[model samples]
Target chain A: MEAQTIVQPEKKKSNQDVIIIKHLNKSFGSNKVLVDFNINLEKDENLVVMGKSGSGKSVLIKCIIGLLEPDSGTIEIFGRNIPDLDRNELDEIRAKVGFLFQGNALYDSMTVRQNLEFPLRRHWMNVNQPEVNKLVQEALDDVGLKHTINMMPAELSGGMRKRIALARTLILKPEIILYDEPTTGLDPGTAKEIIELIVAIQKKYRSSSLIISHDMNCVRLAADRVVMLIDGRCYAEGTYDSLKKSGDPKIKDLIE
Target chain B: MALPVKTTDFLQETGGISVFTGRFFKEAFKPRYEISEFLRQCFVIGYRSLPLIGLTGFIMGLVLTMQLRPSLIEYGVESQLPAMVGIAIVREIGPVITALIFAGKIGSSIGAELGSMKVTEQIDAMEVSGTNPFKYLVVTRVAASTLMLPILVMISDAISLFGSYIGVNINGITSFPLFYTQVFNNLGFSDVLPAFVKSFFFGFAVGIISCYKGFYSNKGTEGVGQSANSSVVISSITIFVIDLIAVQITNVLNLN
Candidate 1:
């Protein structure tokens, strides 16, 4: 008989939705830090979160990164729920995400080169020294700080430190970058430079970015979509122009 | 007024203690080694504490020798005084007293630094960068303490013996060589080893606990003071507790 069994090809799933957070809640004793928080990020999108200082913007990002657990919520990243993952699994997820901390959080003791080299060495052991050097150089170049690669964090200016931190974040070529107050203490000019760098890097790398900032200028310059957090929930989210035109008092206050 | 004040103080103390312990363990194994930061901590913990440890050890030996002189003269066994005091200092007093001083200086500083970092979101920053702040900050610190404290104790013990020699000469005509011989002859491996081993735990406890207090500190400026205070208190108490347990275990083992 010439009859043969039919064969079917398996379809590859799309990772177009990078992050999905739903009904996230967190509390400390009687104080609720995050409540009914929900956010979704598409692949290669730049989302800026803006809020008052204590309005839980940082807390929300921390929860997504698995640094702090939610009281009740689901955080799905790359089609995997974080809370259910074991330590190794969580670590594996974390390796694909980069974070640029507000204070530039560079290791005070290590040279900038070592700081950039550290994560690469840890996660990609098969990477040789020349490859690491080339990658570090590329990252530094992207931040316009290639010359600072050999300097210690203590030796750099605040702006240099921030750039170095950015370089460190870029070293791993992460699929997602989360920035916690990237321009908080910088001078206005330096802040603008950093914001531009953030936008440029995100565009170049095609990585999804979630930037948490109180600075309106940063939100304006870097955000493709702005999510205004207030009272532990997302009060408004749209393009920056739409947020400005919404006439919502809280959004007005944040923009003005 | 006193009731509220007392309650507040108790809460402050308890909160500080809990935060310190929590952070230390949390960050102990995270990666991105801060070698310079670790060295700076060592300098503060090991190098700076040396003067205080040395002075305290010296006084302890001298005072013990002076106090024992009258009793020794009564028994016509004044020559045995050096050995007794030497054993006492190296076996128990040296490590304990040095650790207490270490607790005061190194423990408090670590607690305060880490606490301030926690307050300012530095540790949080470390986490975002894909660096394990625990391994870099806590493990290196604990390791430094474990390694350096024993060396510091050894130096302190030596200085104390010299001080005892000086104290003995103040009353009687005992040469340096004679005093040295007497001290060594009386000290068996049992006396030295147990004391030496105890200090590693002492160092570990001081480092781990102080870091624990500091790393978890919250509540802005208030958390800083809490970190310093709790580090000192817990490390001091733990030194004694560990010492007691070590002694009991050593005695049991030696008995067989």
Candidate 2:
């Protein structure tokens, strides 16, 4: 079945753009992952980057978070160029940015409470034990898994582990959150719950989020704007409804 | 000009390890020492390996004494058993054996651990949380192993001497004080210092190489296994090479 065609509206520019990338290029030897990819995430907006497996969605997110360096171009986060920042400066930028891994990379050796407390202890070195405990409790409470505080990550189920990882990310109260395939491996029901939680958390925290996912449901439910990454570039971008009505075969391929 | 694939891979691996070691040195001395984490690693990498190191040391001492008794009896030097065993264990055998055992237990463990973290993006998550994963994970572990191996060697030497005493009593009687006196009398500063110094290098080789392999590991679960396996192999070989160099250096210095 062919979807009806529609013109996507021009995106309104905002002075509150929290993250801006321009002509970014990243390659692993001869394999170019991101080529001249450009995107901007505005304040308190949920921007989803959708791409197929091996299409560099993770790499893009990694580059933004300083996990992977770009071959060229600028990643301007909060008026600072990421590649140009020194170690200490980069760390300062990172403190304000939270990331959720597809695998829920909770430290296997740490208890849930410890996991939540890691960032707080690291970034807020002067925070007292009582404050640390309270922050840990609050973060876990945000994820609705306060009961799992003392349990090691191994003891938690897959969904619970994801919640704990999210809680850890939340504990920092970061200004920006980058989610790499947030719902990649969960069952449909669990995936829906996570999506809902992400939406709720975004609303509560009002933090800008750059989410990388190929999950259409995740894009539909969680994305305020969606960028389609293809051929190592920003293939297309629009609201989910606008893109769903796009006649471009590439856009149709993803929406369907 | 193109190098053979294997040659290129070997060159890449070597270069990567060297760079990683250099980075460890750089990050290690920087501010924000992970003292508590380093202590935890010391307990894990040093204290936890005790039973295995102890068992092996005991067996090595007992077996060495028994083996030397037959050979020494022919030369009528059987009474010098304690001194010979002591010198052998303290000067060369103790450090090398404990290090090899450490490589087996700790090297593979660090490699698998960091490999899994890389794959799961926990390491990335740490960076996004404003923590230097290298400082937090690598520096702490490498520093712990480097500092702890010498201590482990010392304890292993003591245990081996005790085992040697038991071996001495198996055939004939020797008072504990006399046996220890004979052992200590034969041991000089040269024997102890050189042996002690080399253990740090051994630990460093294991820690740095394993971390290098795991930190850059790819290909998911298989990569984790490969990282673990390669860590042990490379660390064992490096230990022998280092021992050879230490022996040569000691000889040059006339420490023998």
Candidate 3:
């Protein structure tokens, strides 16, 4: 018998039409949070959302992930309206989109390995133990924390914890990564390191990303396109230099 | 002004019930255990609360012994006072009173911590990271409570009996060995097991409901306080409800 290579068709299909949010609106009782929010992400594009706190930056991404229900709007990921999907369907959507929480919200009880392995076990049943282990190690390597896999989240420094959280996001090979304030409280040097990691991961995985942050340095480092959220809407949309020089008072204040 | 008060009261009541029932199933099997966080919770829920539970149990035993001494004398069965009070403490009063104390001390703290985390978007961070906060936060705390409270109750029961022994000797002449023998003679597997089992449910209820209130809290700073208050209130009510059901079932089995 002649030696032959088996080709995988599913792996070749591109995750191009990733996420689309249209005219989404949300309110808490009478206080409106997101008002007519719209955005579309192409494959492997890094879109950064900049806004003051409470401007619904997190809420908008949450709606995309189907964590929050927008009162009236359509969120279509890969051409499927997400809000219409049931719980199982939403879980499927979530599996493909990795999120790094603002606080690096690592589970405090589990070791770093357990934390990284948790989603893999829950969502990837076909993956056996050895394969899971290899993937986890690889993820840790990518985040430069391969040595700290057994350590608990509490034992890690702020940057190390953030890196572990990133490793966790990579474990599932997600196509879209949403970062919520990836560098909010870290020292300037550590924040810069996180920003570098974000860019490296985006390029390495060729993954589409939507980052919600107020950190201008991070915005400049990681954003291919920046969208400023103000008053429950996209206030300005442009590249970093364009946004910086736009001369709009609010945009200027945010940049300066 | 009147309408807002009515609305607030209505929300408080309905939210309590909704949170209790919703958290019961949600926390039962969620993935991602927060170990260090849970231990910290245990320290708060089990260790720190020990003093309060201990004080109450001791006083309960002493007061019950004193109050019943007169009545037992009236029946000319003053010699049986130790055994009667011991059985009461071991069989029902011990677990119930200790659990009530647990609810007040631990339940409210869980509620407040979770509520503050929720208000601050920490819970949302967990959910967005492909981790189920319900499983991580609620399950571990509830499970810890389920495991810890029974142990706590057992310890409390022993201490209370000791206190009762001292109370008996305050006015009469009963040796320590005789006091314990009388107490144990009236207590069987029937009395001890059912009371102990019911406490697990009480602990589970307290942990789950408190976590649910705190995890889903939305109104900001005031919501944290509301969650803490409701956790204690609802868990206390649930303890009684479970006790009644447990008693009824125990009667049906002729086990008590």
Using DockQ, give the best candidate's number: 2
Could you tell me which residue pairs clash in candidate 3? A109-B34, A109-B35, A109-B36, B115-B214
Model 1, A1-256: lDDT tens digits are: 1111122112212348799988888988998878787877878888888889988887888888888888998999998988787756777888888888766777665799998987787677689989998999999999998888788888999998999999888999999999999998999999999999998998899899999999989988988777778778877777777777766677789888
Deviation from native of the Cα of residue A107 in model 3, angstroms: 1.8
Best prediction by TM-score = 2
Model 3 misplaced stretches (Cα beyond 4 Å): A1-15, A245-253, B1-11, B22-77, B90-92, B116-122, B129-132, B135-159, B162-205, B218-230, B233-256
Alpha-carbon error at B17 in model 2, in Å? Answer: 2.4
What digit string (tens of lDDT, one per residue) describes model 2 on residues A1-256?
A: 1112243435553459999999999999999998888888999888999899999998998888787889999999999999999877998888899888889988887888888888887788899999999888888889899888889988988889888889888888999998989888899999999999999999999898999999999999998888888889888878898898778998888778
**Model 3, span B1-256: residue lDDT tens:** 3568879887886686676667656656554456765786677678877888888888888899999999999999999998899789887899999999899888888888888778766576566555567776777788788888998999899888888987898998888888888888877899899988898898888887887778778798999999999889988988999999999999999996
Native interface contact recovery, model 1: 0.30
Using TM-score as the measure, name the better of candidate 1 and candidate 2. Answer: 2
Could you tell which candidate, 1 or 3, scores higher by TM-score? 1
- Pairs with steric clashes in candidate 1: A109-B36, B20-B212, B20-B213, B21-B212, B24-B212, B27-B134, B30-B135, B31-B132
Over 4 Å off, model 1: A1-15, B1-77, B128-136, B143-151, B170-172, B188-197, B240-256
Error of 2 at A37 (Å): 2.2
Colliding pairs, model 2: none
Global fold similarity of model 2 (TM-score): 0.94
Which window of ten consecutive residues has the lowest lDDT sum in model 1 chain A? A1-10
Error of 3 at B68 (Å): 6.6
Give lDDT per model, in order.
0.83, 0.90, 0.83
